[model samples]
Target: MSPVAGTVLAVLLSLVSAAGYALAAVAQARLAASAAPAGRGALRALLARGQWWWAVGLNAAGALAHVAALHYGPLTLVQPLGALTLVAALPLGAYCARRRVTRTEWRGALLTLGGLVGLVAMTGPAEPGEALSLREALIVAAATGLLIAALASGRVPRRRGDTGTRGLGHATASGIASGVGSALTQTLTAALALELPGREPVWWQTALLAVLISGFAVGGLLLSQAAYRGGLAAPLAVVNLSNPAAAAIIGVALLGETFRAGTWGWPIAAAASLVAARGVVLLTKGGAPAPEADPASSTVVVTGSRPVPPPRATELPAPLPAPLSTPLPLTVPLSVPEVEPARASIPG
Candidate 1:
């Protein structure tokens, strides 16, 4: 296939993959209302949800598509384009979860999209380099470990007063983890490449990859769920931006990939990042996302096929009339009149 054709194919697949992710996000968000904290209990709750499983399946599909896109396209192109998932998520949330997106939210989403486009346009071709080395992998792993520890220690405690803050914390944590996960995934992919030809993967290497993938995927997902509990806009934006940002950094550091700086390139990328951040703030300002309706709150009086309705209000009977202070006048005499009886009148 021609280079143009390959790129087109990659772009299409990436968009499709983004769509899948959007759908999955909506599904997971719907289930977020019921989600427990991140741990064995949360894991159990997440596993019990059919929506969670469906979301997982969708996520898997998206990942497969994403990996394929990365195989064909430059990371510069594909990584940034992944932000499209955040924009796509709004409409999917509206459709799948029936959440309404306000005008401000839409504008924010559009701004994010616009910023991503600018960022992409400003980015030039990436420089190529050698395969990932063990030293670089160890460094990445160590950094990831440190980041995870900070995140877990710093933000795991939930704040009743500022759930948003808690959520942002979770989102940041999840994003960093996901970024590391992205690197790990790329590394794993590289490992598999060796197996593609005549080389057989060593058992130890396979086990390590398996463990990393499981930890990254599961850990990132649980944290993501925690993030969503706070709301969509902030955390979602963090995730959308962080994934690519982290991956780009890792790619540059490990892969020796360099960006070709054009006249306005750096400026545009920085400005675009600002615009994306502004859009995320706008999304949070619009309104807190309404939680999925509780079935327990629904009433029989509900008329339609829509999701659960607000609890039905019942009217209380009017208070009984207070007792009269004074006694009312009686229509009849208070006592019956007594009649005199004749002594022997009835004998005859």
Candidate 2:
């Protein structure tokens, strides 16, 4: 197939993967909610769900389709197309959950997809290379460092009274794993194909690829579950951005992919990334926990009228008047009055 046709195929396959991810997420949520207390069977239970099985099958099909597309096109082209899964997963999750997704979600998802498509289209295919080098190792290491930093920051935010923080935590981990996974997959694939002159992949290279694929599958499952449970915008954005960002960097630095758009392409890509990030932040903010109600300020009904009952003899304010012209101020003074000694313990 031509490169153009391969790109199209990759995009279509990504949509299939996205649908699979959404279904798997929902299934994982259901199973997680119903899992046994022992926790020994949680993984099994999650995998046991029929919906989860469907998700796995769909994802595998997507991976195979992606591989086929890559054979015809480029990694820079194909990997970015895979980000379309985020677009597909959101609406699919909403529909399956029997909920109507908000306009904000649709806009965010679409913008994310558009931004990714642009970023990928700009990148040319990977250079045919056989083996990993020290320079590539250093680059991967730097990316990994950034990933770790993000995770640390996510944790700190959660610790500081951020109740909606789990989503961020989950997203961060997912993003790092997805990004590294995609990059490594590319590296492994190129190596195993014997693309490099005078080099061939040994048993370890094949084993490594197997491990990476398994990790990607499992991580993708949990991440999708977390994303669907948390809502699409943030998790999807993180995954979409991180995976391609990692892949794009590798494509440019190691695989020698480039864009004719010049310096502007870099900034545009960064801006698009931030836009997606803002959407996630907004989604997370919207899901924050509400403040607790103050029972003291609340009104209680003692017959027809709402009133604050007087304290008992043991308590202060015995036989307090009811239904006054104006409700007695429930405000608490800084200093307590000596006369109302028993009531002094309670706030004025």
Candidate 3:
């Protein structure tokens, strides 16, 4: 395809992918209401649910579509386009849950939209960088491993009284993993491009790249859901913000792509990113937990990513009182003579 056609195709594919992601997020949120605790048992229960399955399928489709888009267009261009998911999620949430979109959500969405516009406009043409080297991949792996360890350490936040603080931490940590996963997509695209000729060595390399990308993507998915269950707006913003940035960096570093950031480009991009981050914060603030929210179970009710509480015990009602004894007939048989009036009548 020509450059114009390729770019258009990439844009269209990215949009469809965004829609899929929105639907998946909605499905996951509903399943969360009945989702088991986060563990082997919960995973099993999650898999058993149709909504959960739908989410997996939709996200997988989105990922595949995303990779295809990257294969054709610049990562910087395509990555930022993924931000469409946030905007799409708003209406999807309303339709699926039959709830109204809050003003805070709209404000956040608007901010995200504006930030995306600025980010995309500021992005310059990308140069095709060299494919990811083995050393670089290893470095990425080590860094991500450490990040996961720190996030999972269960260290309490300094302000224990403030609810959602720890959850935000979890969201941030998981968002980083998502960013790495986005980078992996760019790497995969490069590897796939090298494999078109079908040489034996290239085939092996491509296979390796595929495995790596799959691993990271799955890991990202797990972390992302965890982040969602842990916190919504914070994690949502974190993922949306970091994922593209990470991909852009990878495109420049590993894929031989150039962003051509000039004297003003860096500042513009930075400002736009900050705007997007602020918008995400607003989205979360607007969707604050209810006053009577159970720190754990309430997560299942509204916060999409936060951990879902196990199915509440089915409440059985109390038994009803026994029926009153049956009443006797008004008329009595002569031989039965139930009343004392018979004795008085014989004496008279």
Q: Pick the candidate with the highest lDDT.
A: 1
> How much is 233 displaced in model 2, in angstroms?
3.6
Candidate-wise lDDT, in order: 0.69, 0.59, 0.66
Cα deviation of 39, candidate 1, in Å: 6.5
lDDT of candidate model 3 versus the reference: 0.66
> What is the TM-score ranking, best to worst?
1, 3, 2
Candidate 1 per-residue lDDT, tens place, 1-348, comes to 889988998999899899888888777777885636665676777788788889889989998998899888886678667778988888776666565778887888878777766665554433432334444555786777788667756543453334334466667777777877766665666666662222555767656765876787888887787777766665787777666666667766656655556555568778988998777777666535445666666655445665544443442232224333334544234433322244345665
Question: By TM-score, is 2 or 3 better?
Answer: 3
> Candidate 2, which segments miss by more than 4 Å at Cα?
1-14, 29-51, 69-81, 129-165, 197-201, 216-220, 223-229, 285-348
Compared with the true structure, what per-residue lDDT tens digits does model 3 show for residues 72-116? 888667867887887888777667767777888789878976786
Better of 1 and 3 by TM-score: 1
Which model is ahead, 1 or 2, in terms of TM-score? Answer: 1
Model 3 misplaced regions, further than 4 Å: 1-10, 68-78, 120-126, 152-170, 173-175, 185-208, 230-234, 251-261, 293-348
Between candidates 1 and 2, the one scoring higher on lDDT is 1
lDDT, ranked from best to worst: 1, 3, 2
